[model samples]
Target: MADLSLEQADIIGRVALERARAGNSQPLTVVVLDAGGHVKLARREDGSGIARFDIAHGKAWGALGMGISSRGLAARAAKMGTFFTALAAVTEGRMVPVPGGVLIRDGGNRIIGAVGISGDTSDVDEACAVAGIEAAGLAADIEER
Candidate 1:
């Protein structure tokens, strides 16, 4: 398994910020997590809310923990609210089932990390994450079911 490098994580963060700015999105908070669900990089834009970091981290952490994009988790949560509630409690509220979390995969199609963004609509946050991952020459896995 390949590890996500600091350089790659930096690029992801930078490009994500750029994407958000280019799109005229509200200030954003971006969090990149290693496959092990550790924060590799986190960036909070100037006007982003204070809670954005936690929300972003939760998105990425949930994706890593569940082995799927947060969008998929959102769908699952809708279908199984009780289970998702339990999952949230089990994770100590670290799991956020939403569209902003995206899995990052290396060239060989192996997941190396995940990126999460907040401070905008879930769809917009997800687009920024995808843009950043692609900018870093990695595949962005978004489960939109």
Candidate 2:
């Protein structure tokens, strides 16, 4: 399994922030989590909400844990509301089914980590994450329905 490097995590965070700025998004919080669901890096822009970190972490962690983009999770949640609610309870609120969490894949298509961004609309946050992952020469997996 390929591991997520510190350099890659840094690049993802930096580029995501730049994308957010270029898109005129409200302040953002970005979190990168290794495949094992450990946080590799986290950043919060000025004016980001106080819960931004937690929200970002939850998004990444949820994606990592479920082996799918949070967008997919959101879709699943919509169809299985009771199950998703149980998931959130079991995770103690760590799971956030939303569009901003994306899986990071290596050249071989192996998932190495995940990136989560919170701030603007979920779609905008997801776009920034995809940009950052691509900038780092990695693939961003967003399981679109």
Candidate 3:
């Protein structure tokens, strides 16, 4: 499996921030997590609330831990309701079943990590992640599966 290196993490963070700005979205906090759910990098831009960083981290951590994109989790949450809430509780509130978390994959389609962005609409945040992964010559698991 490919590892999320510091250089790649930096590229992902920078691209996400730039995409957020280009789209005229709110300032964003982007968080990248390795396959083990450890934080590779986290960044909150100026004008973004501090909470965004935590939220973004939660999303990415949740995705890495659960082995699914947060968007998929969100959809599952909608159907599962309190069970999903309980999952958040069970995971110590690290499981953010929201739309911003996305799995990152290498060329062989192995899950390498995840990226999460906050401080804008969830859709916009997800877009930035997808863009960043593509820009880095990687792939988003959402697109693959």
Each model's TM-score, in the order given? Answer: 0.97, 0.97, 0.94
Candidate 3 residue spans exceeding 4 A from truth: 143-145
Across 34-136, the per-residue lDDT of candidate 2 in tens digits comes to: 9889989999999999999998898888998799999999999999999999999999999999999999999999999999999999999999999999999
What is the alpha-carbon lDDT for the whole of candidate 3? 0.86
lDDT (C-alpha) at residue 59 in model 3: 84
> In angstroms, how far off is 122's CA in candidate 3?
0.7
Clashes, model 2: 0
In candidate 2, which residue ranges exceed 4 Å CA deviation?
none
Cα deviation of 46, candidate 1, in Å:
0.5
Comparing 1 with 2 on lDDT, the higher-scoring candidate is 1
Please estimate how well model 1 matches the true structure, expressed as its whole-model Cα lDDT: 0.95
Question: Residue 69, candidate 2: how far off, in angstroms?
Answer: 0.3
Give per-residue CA lDDT, model 1, range 18-50, as digits (tens). Answer: 999999999999999998999899999998999
Q: Candidate 3 lDDT, tens digit per residue, 1-145?
A: 6588878988888898888889999889999998888888888888999689889998888888778899988888888898988988898998887888999989887899999899888899999988887888888875312
Error of 3 at 141 (Å): 1.9
Clashing pairs in 2: none
**RMSD, each candidate, Å?**
1.0, 1.0, 1.5
Model 1 spans > 4 angstroms off: none
